[model samples]
Target: MLGVPKDEKPTWISRLAAQPAVHRAIRTFRLQELTSAALKVRPIKRRLPKSGIEYRVRYLESFLMADEIFQRKIYREAFEGLDVRSFVDLGSNVGYFPLFAVELTGRRDLVGIAVDGNRSMTDETRWHVDHNHLANVKPLWGIVGYPSDVKEATFYLNPSNVSCSAQPVLNPDVPSKGRIKEVTVPTVDVASAWMQHAGDVRVDVLKIDVEGFEREVLRTCGALLDKTSSVVVEWHKWIASQDEVEALLRDRGFVRFRTISEDPYCGVAVYRPRAS
Candidate 1:
């Protein structure tokens, strides 16, 4: 309840539990089971036969993300026939997206830059890249969506590792078991950093999921959008609406062609240059 917004309405389940002592007891029992499950979670080693890659995921969220990327095929179109020689993930958690790119493209030579604001998560990403022998994938510990002049920024690390975000006020509601932690991380400007990492090659696929700081990310994207071929962004409407995000991309000559998934809290959309 700490992170719940003041104006937010109670969820149906919350309302249901408030009706009777029996309902409240049921809710309490369910919550206890959920907490027990969370406590028992341990590192899991999973191998994707198609990709021929073994993932070392520590958290339940990481496994769920694996399901999203590998099973759901949310970004399938982004890699279908794009000849993705290079890609960048703005909020790479444990490097699943880039791994999926490698799997989807079947290109071991593919170059990827995975960036994360949380040091622990970034380290996990690096472990995945190293252990899996993804020679071309580089894991960076930094924050994106800020001006190049800005060297470092404050980042909030949520208990759900994948929910780590740059915007302080955009923190997601967490279980009462854990509190949000703040840390300063180095900032990256995609334009300059991309060139430095993978040379001047146009970005084959650009995946952005910086929690709710997407507007800032797009603002600093500058001319880099022109050099990008495909963009798959997960937009948080609570901080910046889908329309606002799409408008920013439209201004840079992009058109939203697909809405992979959507909900009240967030949505994932794919974009491509209008001329293409």
Candidate 2:
């Protein structure tokens, strides 16, 4: 309820619950459990305007649904004409960003590698790719950070949200932390993952949404930095400060940067390599 929008309309179940006839019919049919189960899913399929591309996603289970719905125009503006031939989505829950890239660029042949630490999420992403007959989406299941196999490394799984992370503290002030479970997942360095997944291919767009562990993910990408033209990162003040993130990118030669969101703590930033 906290993250849900103010003007969000009632779900179908809420509407049905309001009607006595609907309840009576369900009780008569003895399908209350089935009906209840079906009503819980929110927006199973999303169709991009003018692209004729439809993606089936678990919208309610992840935070990405809001982005896919409300932030459609923003993504179009940020990546529409970026010439993204090879794209990598870190923390790709159900693979919406990759689909956006393919649809926006109008290049179905573009290479997309979706990386997520959660096995179920990776499986779901693979299913989406297979369901759409997409040969370009490479879904990889592994923790995204440098110095793999650390002793204390653990991923905190959010019960309601699919976008879980290694860092547990979302915000002390924010009551809804969303973390429900913890699991030890195999880790992969960002630089190695880029080379192994995208190899020899210049990644035109690199999108990372690794919850709070962004610094670790960005620290080891020096090898992949030159190949990447546009970098989009969701920075969280709860995990790492914004100044550290900006300075890291600037030191790597991405001098041109712009803030996408007004919230410094929960902000999105776009960076491009400095002109030589």
Candidate 3:
């Protein structure tokens, strides 16, 4: 449906203008921070980038939180300039990037599968897909991680953020990484979920952003990787070293296309590999 804009709109300013001052005052502490946070977690309705279809969007909570830590646009740019007709989004947070990438493929026949451990986030993803008249996107909620036979595990729900991860968190300054309460969620084997939701379609883009569970998830995804054309991953060094991550990609015939500094502890990698 679309690609990056030739002249991107100054979204930060508009996001602030759209929010009433009373709401911002009640939830937010400063105006500059609100504008800065307008970059990634968009919860507003705008035309779906290039789809020419008006969508009902759910931007991140505009109240009680000032910003989003995850930069969704970086993933958008990573998926660009590819032949991605279909995609799989792991750790799908309210289906932001998958929906964006669905528009990016500019293909009406594409299949989009969004997976998340959080039920609420999955519901939101499903709602966005259905309400936007997009029959291509599907949202699946279950626990998925590095372990193959993980029957069940504790899922940390960050009440304050959309990206509540699977790992135990400490810092409160990082949005969802803090204020977590553990709850048991049903686990789904990655391969099983892939077979069930993805069916037989070739997935062009396989994205993994499972907080700190990237290693095991990637380790078991060799066969899926063999069929995938590209990958977008947020590899955190705290969970696994960068050297280890790079080596894993190298062994799998995935050449890193772009690397964006996400933080001191984490980095986003976009990869292109041989079409098997």
Candidate 4:
């Protein structure tokens, strides 16, 4: 019998079959190595520059993350041309946004009033302000609601989840697993807070991010919005319907208002109407 040709041999068939498997294994190994290298280099690539205010953020990255910095950047761009002499940071947990505003605007004349419903959060904000030697930023402990000076309310305090609000979050379905400590604190409207100061303070930007209580905050700040040049708020659907918020602002002469993004948790809207 004549021997089979090498190309047509059984051994050759077996080798060809093995070749693809070998190549696939090699490719998989290479991909794994590439992923490992990327994981190693990612942190270094994300490192902020050595100088400037961004570098200072590195000191407090645990408290404030990259997403928060990006949010502040968005706020800065939204109010670029306007002269922002005063800023009201409603629900200013740990003072990240307000501090970032101070850095971006480079306006020492800017006075930031940081209001937080949580006492510990306001205390933390005070610590950061004092540590950074930011004289203009004032931390106040209270909820921004229907203009009032009362010191007693069922202030719900979540020790672990400190950013959660003292006021009942509009979403009752969402479970608050964190502990609630009933703390005593004052409540005031955004307008009253501005009025308490000695001089005729012109509010250029009002940033409200009070979880799901944004609706009540806006209702209380009606007078302040009338005086403010721009109002930036993280709108929540659970808190108030879009139409209701729009109508409220419209009634206060906020003719031009638009949502910046559709982020579920942190959707931002900028309201710029004719100055009063």
Candidate 5:
């Protein structure tokens, strides 16, 4: 897929010109004043309180934004009744989901392998893991896909935003403003990588949120699905159709599982293969 162009200044200007009237109005507002007001409403330096776990949780609520809440909800539902020994967190942007999983499972025996195509995100994840003294998790930097050995692809680096995918996807309706950098990285087959590194280990839960590349990763990891007890994926609308993903999983013996959220844009689906 074509990465964002090296000379993205034109694209950035075009994006600004295409913004909706409401967004344009917001941009015209006193930027610093708006930022100050937001900070006053929710300060960034607020720390988790030192108290009982319940009190700490209450304090933590001040820190969690919308995405964190969504991640927590899915983590709870995915591992509710099962014993999760190992978790494979693909596209683990800041390791928040993996950390949340560790806290939810409450198991020191837990092993987490967090992978992302962005090196900076992986570094941040590593820092967060070490800062929290999480000994069981390992963060890897790479893209996962069907062609494991493929070495070169245009990678789009969206400033400090690591969750943004390197894959080329254009939405005529949505406008974006920012510079993107070109990067080259190694891509691996999910199944082969897991087998090589996590061979003897059984994966209890696998969570994937690779922007638009989820289907490709699944295709590459077909051999490892049998050992996976459950899979949770945030399907991308631009890459593969829902019916296609469902059929692919069905052929592999998995059944569609629902999530609590109704937002189809970021639908979270769980799958468990039928027992023989």
Candidate 6:
């Protein structure tokens, strides 16, 4: 994979872009407002600065996500000092985090698997992988759950948003007209699915953002949890409190390093194996 451009703008530019004041100003000033409004009818390709990778996205959700992953450096701390050769992404929306990982690691042979329950989101993720010639990253479409939970599951799709969930009531916007679409998707175990792609190789990093199904998704990892070096998770407060999230990981022999971000809806934290 090609590296960040030498002539790319300074890191401060990205820091500035990540600031809340600047983000609000950009929206308030109608900088992206007009463009975003126009793009609602059709999606467009936007490149991440420095990485030379372009992602195909339609709504403001993706724009905000791009800024969070690339500009805000949301997962940077989780990735630092780790030898990331293989990664697994659960509930990958447009697959920005996997792409960011590849760039941050600067590893040409890194392998990534991005899994999403939404077929459209999977297609979008595939486009990014193919367009950027990221052959090592594989996008799989399926609902990740415990191995014995169900063979097929109902996935509540949020057409206007990427944060779909198995729990119908999880999306607050679902009460509105035509906002939610119910679809049955095949379910796969996380460890089993990953083993099919990378065999028995240890996962360097595992990222989870599965709406309100974080605990169920984590259950599917099974023994692979022992083989993973670090985990970055965005836990929904309604499904599990921050302490509950920590307790779940603790039972699996992982300890929380620190939280990256926290809001009413969800919080992101990094975890590593407990020291002997």
By descending lDDT, how would the candidates be arranged?
1, 6, 2, 3, 5, 4
lDDT of 6 by residue, 1-276 (tens): 011122333345444533457645654665554565777578777776666777766655676677667765678778877878999888888778777886788764678789898997888788878888888889999888757557899999864345587766563322322357899998877787778888999898888888888887776675778888899888877677778778878989999886776644567888999872
User: Per-residue lDDT for 275 in model 4?
Assistant: 56
The collision pairs in model 2 are none
List candidate 2 segments past 4 Å from native. Answer: 1-43, 59-71, 148-152, 177-179
lDDT of 1: 0.74
- Candidate 2 per-residue lDDT, tens place, 1-276, comes to 112122345444334433547535644564533443463465356666756667764534333353533343344435634667888788887677776776677777778688888777788778767766668668888777766445235878764344478777654443342336888877766666667766788888788788787887788677777788888887777788878888888888986455555343466767888883
Better of 1 and 3 by TM-score: 1
Best by TM-score: 1
Please, what is the whole-model Cα lDDT of each candidate in the order they appear?
A: 0.74, 0.65, 0.63, 0.59, 0.60, 0.73
Better of 1 and 4 by lDDT: 1
**Per TM-score, what order, best first?**
1, 6, 2, 3, 5, 4
Candidate 6 global TM-score: 0.82
Mind giving the per-residue lDDT tens digits that candidate 3 earns over 8-98? 3424633453344633362455443454257336555556557654443344342211122122244665666767778888887666665
Put down candidate 5 lDDT per residue, 1-276, tens digits, no spaces: 111122222234224323455333534564424554575476443222221112011111122321243323445566756888888888877566665665676654477788888886688578656766668778888777746457656566653243357576633233332455778877756666666666768788888777677777777787777788888776666566667777777877888765533232445667777772
lDDT of 1 by residue, 102-184 (tens): 77877777887888899977888898889888898888899988878899999998665666789766423322224578988
Per model, state how many residue pairs clash: 0, 0, 6, 0, 1, 0
Worst 10 residues of 1 by lDDT: 1-10
Task: Kindly give the stretch of ten consecutive residues in candidate 6 with the minimal lDDT sum.
Answer: 1-10
